[model samples]
Target chain A: MLYIALKMLMADRAKYTGLLLGIAFTAFLVTFAAAYFSGFMTRGFALIAENGAADVWVMDAAVESVEQTINMPDSALDRIRGVEGVRYAVPLALGTVDARFPNGRFQTFQVIGVDDATLAGAPVLKDGGVPTVLRAPDAAIIDDGGTSGKLLTPVLKTDQWPHDGAHLEAAIRELAVGDELLANDQRIKVVGRSETLPRFPPRPLIYTTFANAARILPQERHLLTFVLATAEPGLSPNDLAQRIHARTGLRARASEDFKTDTVRWYLVNSEDVGDMAAMLILAMSVGFGVTGVLLYIFTYENLKQYAVLNAMGATPRVLLSMIFAQTGICALTGTGLGLGACVLVGEITAKAGYPFRMMWFTPLLGTVGVLIVSLTAAAISARPVLKLQPAVVFAGR
Target chain B: MSTDANHEIAVRCQGVTKTYGTGVAQVAALRGIDLDVRQGELLMLVGPSGCGKTTLISIIAAILDKDGGQCKVLGHDLEQMSQNDRVRFRGKSIGFVFQVFNLLPSLTALENVAIPLLLNGVPRGRAEERVRSALDSVGLGERMNAYPAQLSGGQQQRVAIARALVHNPKLIVCDEPTSNLDHKTGQDMMDILRGVAQSPDRALIIVTHDPRILGFADRIAYMDDGRITDIIAGKHRGQLQ
Candidate 1:
């Protein structure tokens, strides 16, 4: 009977294809929305999220999230280092500087200064090397997602530039090793290219040693933005943060707690995050509506066959199982196709410099949405079958 | 009085009554129907449109409930059985052939014929074997893999009959089994049905208005205004015709 059900469903090629397309389109929309939202949320706290080695972060008492933090005095790192249960503490300086390219193009760049001795906060270099090259005078490492939002070598756009002088976001080049640029009127040379976590509304990221950052950045009383710390082996990060807070009188948080705080702040204050979440809900609602209605129409069109089966002595349970099997095939296939397409698109967008972070949980969440669509469709489609009278088969031949 | 021939009765109905709708819209489809179908019998029910011929057969098949009556098929009271048991009994012991040759259009003739056996929980391999033999019995052996739309009207009807008989049900009920066929095709369908109706332990009932196939019935019951007005032996009726 299940085979019969499948045969009956497959007999009408147009309807079956229409049903599959309906499910696939819905799944794709849901997956795209979820992946985009996941990407946006992850980028909201890129600095905190990317530095997985740090167990705790100490900043000014008023700082709520990484993006909204105020600069703290450089002495805060030394005080945090002296706290009990602290393994090591390093000063991190993050500031925006006006960078003047050799072509005289001026763009704002976010300059991050990690500890000169440890270089603990620098991103991993694309060439599988450390940022030790930043140890050289007036040298810095820029992320691959810099300047042109791509890793192209720095060059003036002319007859020789790729894409017919049209700068493609994909073809734009980051500042490469030995490329000189002016920051805050100080000349600096790119020493290496590193791959860093992406940021929304992407800006060029440049890393330098603490002493160099102070030179490239405008002078100020407080030069450090955050104090990255590691907890002792036996102490939990939360406990160590509490100890740091009690001793230094500055706000402190575990890495995970800070990440959560960042995301929470965005959720509360950023309309973009709220709008993206609402868009996700809208996509799911549309998916449910379209898939459910299409499935219902498909079932309604085949009601006569169901009546024939019922008149042939199939129990309601048997008929329901057949319907479920049909729905399962559609749901599983659509989910696989939609998710596969999402992954492929994620790859394309990531390569093209679009913020598209697809964690494992995003697709898992999309699958749950698809399942809801399937169950809703099955439940809605089953009503007509349940109410069908087998005697309808005897009507008008 | 009807002659029993000392054979066991497959279907017995007494004072069966059925009504459609409710209130002023209510129309009584059956006032009272009392009939007995015996084993080894091929009974033809002939009647005018809306005369309750189909209603009576549907009730006998346990697909519809009667307002008041005692209807027993193969010694089990249909009214006393629960819905699940009725479904089980129908799956295990009864078969139905529809006028439209209600073979699932997507399935080949072989797969269509295997539906009843599958519904009854027969393993797929055995079910396919039985389906092949059933289609072969109806002279459709070469067209086993042909879809319904690919087959002619007569061939489709034959597939329907094979489906009806594949589970070896003790009773088979057909509604307008040959109404869609042309003169020769109708007769051919009747011939095939008559061949399968010879099983001594099973019975067949065909509800139809087509008079050309009357000779194939072992007994004919004429219905008018929801009552059986006549019962005649097939041999005697053939002589009169």
Candidate 2:
């Protein structure tokens, strides 16, 4: 019976091929979009997680976004450092600054600054020398995650931001190492680029000494934005966070919570490239819908032969089982091919400096979606098939 | 069991009525048919259009349900059986040949023949052997792999016959098996059917319109307006003309 089922499916090779291709194309786009969206968000906010050295993070209150630069005084960092089970405290500043390059092209980047001599105490994103950037007063390191190459293109302020709608393509041409950038006329040279540093599209990234960062965006008198505290061994991380929140009037969060906060921040408050993402998602969904419909048409055409089988004393259940089994096999095979396509395309697209990435979890989701949609398409054709009366062949009327 | 098996009737139907739909659209396809096909007899049903020969044959074959009275093929009563049970009974004990040669287009000749046996839960290999022997019996040994479209009309019809007899069913009901063939081919088909339809243990009931088929039947039944109006007297075999 299974052989008969397979034979019936294979008889219409052209139709089955078309169905497989349609399903594969739909699955590829949906999974790829989901993966890129996930990968983009993860790469964008990696710095906050790296810098938070505490068993938990304690912020002032109601801070929805990490890039918003909520402030606390030096008294808070000092207070957390003195709390029991706390090993060390590092004061950090995250601010936006206009970077002027030697080529007179300027761009903007988020400047992350931490007061740590070894740079291990700072989230370096694996910059070449932690000691150099950590100690350099006028020197800062850059992350190459979004940069085209090893050279870090410094983005200086072209004109006053928040008022000037200056586009990036014209402002910055080529960012390379050793290029000098000016922030409020304070000159600094670009150091080596780090590999996994936090960045967004158009390279919203820069690194500088805490004192150097204070020059462009001055810190309020006796104010600290985030305190990075290391936990001593043998101390429960959650317990330490509780003790810190109890001692200092601030919210303490664990590492997972800290990551969640940053993700929540960008998701809710930030001006995301929303239209592009929405359009991509819609395209993916429409592609899947079209594939499903086309597959339904193809499977319906294929079942014309099976009607003859049923009329020959093949059971109706036999017909159904055969069609669904074909759907399952085609769905699984097509999804495998689609996943392969996504991986190959993702690599090429990523190298071409696009935001596409390959994530296995999202592709699994895509496989499930494809299977359901394909089978549903196959199921839609059952009406005409079951209605194929044996008498139809003889009477032809 | 042996004594009864030797003398038992293969097909019997009494006061069977097949009506289609209701109200103004109502039609009695087979008004009321009383028929009995003895074991091993090759019976041919002949009639013109609207004569209900096919409908009567269908009821006797257990393919269509009768609106009134009873039909029994082999041993089981049609009215008392479940739908699936009826189908299974037909697959196991009876076989049918249509004028259209309704073999699945996707299957090879051998596979087409094996379908009945396979439906009976006979494994493929054994089914294939039976199918092959049946095909050989119909002289289609060289064309096992060929599809119905690939075969000539005569060849396809033989494949249909082979399929019908592959299970060695006790009752073989063929509707117009020779109507689609040329005279010689039709005669050849009857010869093969007569060879297999012989024996006191099996019966063949065929519904056909060709006068040339009268020579091949042990008994001939005539239908008109869904009623079995006349049956050629057994003593006047060739003299009925």
Candidate 3:
């Protein structure tokens, strides 16, 4: 009976194709939006992930995330270094400064200052390992994707640069080594280039010694933004963070915990998070709406065949099984196609430097959503079939 | 079982009444039908449109519920049995043929014929073998793999008959079995149905309006307004017309 049901479903070519397409489109929307959202979250926490050597980060008590920087007294770094479980502690300074290119193109770049002696928090250099160039006078290292490529392009009257991630990447890549730029009237030279993870709204990223950073900006009594720390042998990062928090009277977070905190902060504070969530919900609605209507019409059109089966002494269970089998075929096939489309789109956007991360759970989430759509459609469509009288086969020819 | 009063009767209906709707819209399909179809006989119920031939057969086939009646099929009281039990009884004991040859268009003739046996829980291999033999008996062996759309009307009707006989049910009911076919095709269909559907313990009932195939019936029951007005011997061989 199931075999016959399948054959009957396959016989109507137009309806079958329409149903499959509807299901596939729904699956595609769900998976694509989820992957995009995952990509956004990964970018949101890039600062924590990029500083691989740091096991703990000590910040001001009021600071919730890396994006929300709160300056701490420079004395906090030394206090954290004296904690029992700490192996070593280094100062990290994060501040944005205005840079004017030699071509008079003015832009703002994120300046990260590492420990002057150890270069402990510096981005890994592209070719020159561990960047000794920062020791030079008035020297700074720029990201390979950061400067002298498209970032230095003068802002056009008509706004030639489209405000998107790809355009931002092109802007970052405009700067190069051996170029001198100005930060707040202080002359600085790009001495090296390095590769690093991209953050959201790609900025011109500059790395320099803490001393040079201090000299370029106005002097202040409290200069440290965060203190990056490592755990001693046999001590977990969480334990080291707790010790630092206790000793220094500052908020200390394990690196992993800091990443979670950053993501949570963005969720609560950013409109982008809400926008991505809305897109995901809309995808799910489209999936259910399109697939449900198509499946219902297909089943309704084939009611007569079902009636024949009913009259032939098929129980409700048998008929239900047949409908379920049809749903399974459409649901599984649609999910596979949708996921495949997501992977294809993920590749294309990634090449264009767009943020899109398809995790295992995203596809799993998509499959569940598609299954719900198919089953709900089947339940709605099966009502008429369950009530069909076999005697309908005896009606007008 | 041998001493039961309806032992030799394939179907027995007494005071069976079926109404389509209620109140002002009420249409009584069967006023009070009393019918008995005996074993080893092909009974033809002949009537015009709206005369309740199809309704009476539907009640006998256990596919429709009568408003009030005592309807027994092969000693099983249809109204007394639960819906599930009645469906089970119908699956294992009865077969049906329709004038339009209600073959599933998606299936080949062989698969269509195998449906009844499969519904009765026969394994696929054995059911298919029986289906093949039944089609062969109806002289449709060469066209077993052909879909109904690809076959002629006469050939399609033969496949329907083959399906009816494949499960070896005790009774087979056909409605308007020859109404869609031309004279020669209709005659050919009747020949196949009458030749393959008669046995000592099995019975066949056909409800139709065509008189050209009357010669194939063992007895013809003429109906008018849901009542059996006359029953006469058919023009079957060695029987009075």
Candidate 4:
């Protein structure tokens, strides 16, 4: 039976080849695009999440997401720290700041100011440790991912060229590493250039002390946007969030909630990213539709052979099983080949710095889509087998 | 119903009726026809178009349901059995040959012939072994891998015959088997069918209008307008001469 089914596939190799290509192309594109989008969102929110922080983000009630500014009193941290099951509550400032290199290269960077001596949000900077630069009042750390608002690659040391192009804070990049920046009229030096792991295109973040951010924008700078606190043994994040919300009129989220919120906020508001993801889904859907049609037509064209089998004393069930077997093979092959091609193409594109990423299970989802389309096609063609009049073989008379 | 008939009777049908559609639109394709194939006898069902010859052959093979009748093939009541059982019964007890060869285009000659045996749960190795001997018997040993489109009409019919014989079924039913063949090729096909009737354990039923095959059958059953008219002994035609 396997031989016969495979023979059928081989006999129509040209046609099946077309079908497989369609399935493969869709699987490749959709999986690769979806992975890149998800990866980007994950990387963006990972730093805050890695801190493993306070359950409640004490902010002005109007702030919708983490990135939004909502200054609370400095005393709120002391109060939250004293709550039950709260291991520790520390002040955290989340705001975008401008950083400059001497070469007129400026970029916007997320200014994550932590009261802890170590810079919490710099994310494993490679060139220099965030701990040393962030602890000093006059010295600060800059994210290589943080986009320098300027594009000068000439002046910085041979290795200090800005790799991250996305600028979030406009104030950071124009200042030279050794030069003084008047943040709120107080001079602060960019002592070192540091980069987080996998900093492809830098976000150009400036890691500073909370007091230093206050000097840059006194009105915008206040108590940290949210504090990080770990739970004691047997304490739950939900319960802790409730406690913080009750006392501060602020919303608290589990560690997962912050990550989810960041992704949700980006998806809902970022038109570019949303459009990209939507386009991929659309392409994936087309792949599904194409595969479905190709598979259905192949099944339909092969219907006569099946009917002939029926006339030759094959049971309808046997014929149905054969058809299904053929469909299953087609779906798996197409999806399998598609995933392989996606990885290959994605690797090539990623090496070229094209932002191509393939998730481990995105191809599985692609396969699921292929199967859905395939089964639908199979179901449609299968109807004829049920309705097939075995008497039709003798119809030519 | 047949205590007197020998156990070797390969097909027996009693009072079978088949109709198409319902009410005023219905046409009775067969009207209460009785059929029987004894032991290894080669029977020809001869009738004009629409005479229910094909329908009768199909019902006997369990390919079509008899509207009213008890049809037995190899001692199993086809009408009484469930659809699945009938399928197993057909795969096990019967082989079918049709006009136009009806070979699955996607499969080679060897693969097509081995299908029934495969569906019967015969392992691929065993099926290929049987198919090899069957095709060799039909003189198609050199063309086993040739697809249906590559074979001539007579050769295709020969492959169909091999497919039927590969499983060593108790009964073989050929629906207008020679209608698509030329005079000489039809004679060649009848000769091929004759070689496979090697034992009394198997029987062949040929539904054909070709008078050239008249000499190959032990008896020829005649029908018109969906009713059997007569059965002539084709074997003793020389005696008539």
Winner by TM-score: 3
Model 2 chain B weakest 10-residue run by lDDT: B232-241
Ranking by lDDT: 1, 3, 4, 2
Per-prediction DockQ scores? 0.58, 0.33, 0.61, 0.45
Off by over 4 Å in 3: A12-18, A103-105, A126-130, A144-150, A153-173, A215-221, A246-249, B1-7, B236-241
Among these predicted structures, which one has the highest DockQ?
Answer: 3
Model 3 chain A weakest lDDT span, ten residues long: A164-173
Q: Give the per-residue lDDT of model 1 (tens digit) for B1-241.
A: 2445567889998889988889999988888888888888888899999889999999899888899878889999997899889888888888888888888888899888888888888999999999999988999999999999999999999999999899999999999988888999999888888787448888889999999888888889988888888888885234222
List TM-scores for all candidates, in order. Answer: 0.84, 0.82, 0.89, 0.78
Pull out the clashing pairs in model 1: A152-A173
Model 3 Cα displacement at A138 (Å)?
3.3
How many steric overlaps are in each model, in order?
Answer: 1, 12, 12, 32
Model 3 lDDT per residue over A145-211, tens place: 3233434532341232244312322223245566777898998888877777777646778899898
Candidate 2 structure quality by residue, lDDT tens digits, B109-221: 98878888887789998888888888888899999999888999899999998888887788888878888899999998888887765566888888888888788886788
**What is candidate 1's lDDT per residue for A251-337, written digit by digit as tens?**
999998998898888889888788878877887888778888888888888888888888777889988998888888878887788
Give the least accurate 10-residue stretch of model 2 chain A, judged by summed lDDT. Answer: A159-168
Model 4 over residues B1-241: C-alpha lDDT tens digits? 2223443677788888999888999999998888778766788899888888988887887778778978878888776788778767777878878887888888889988888888888888888888889999999999999998999999999998998888888888888888898999998888888866435677788898887788888778998988888887787334322
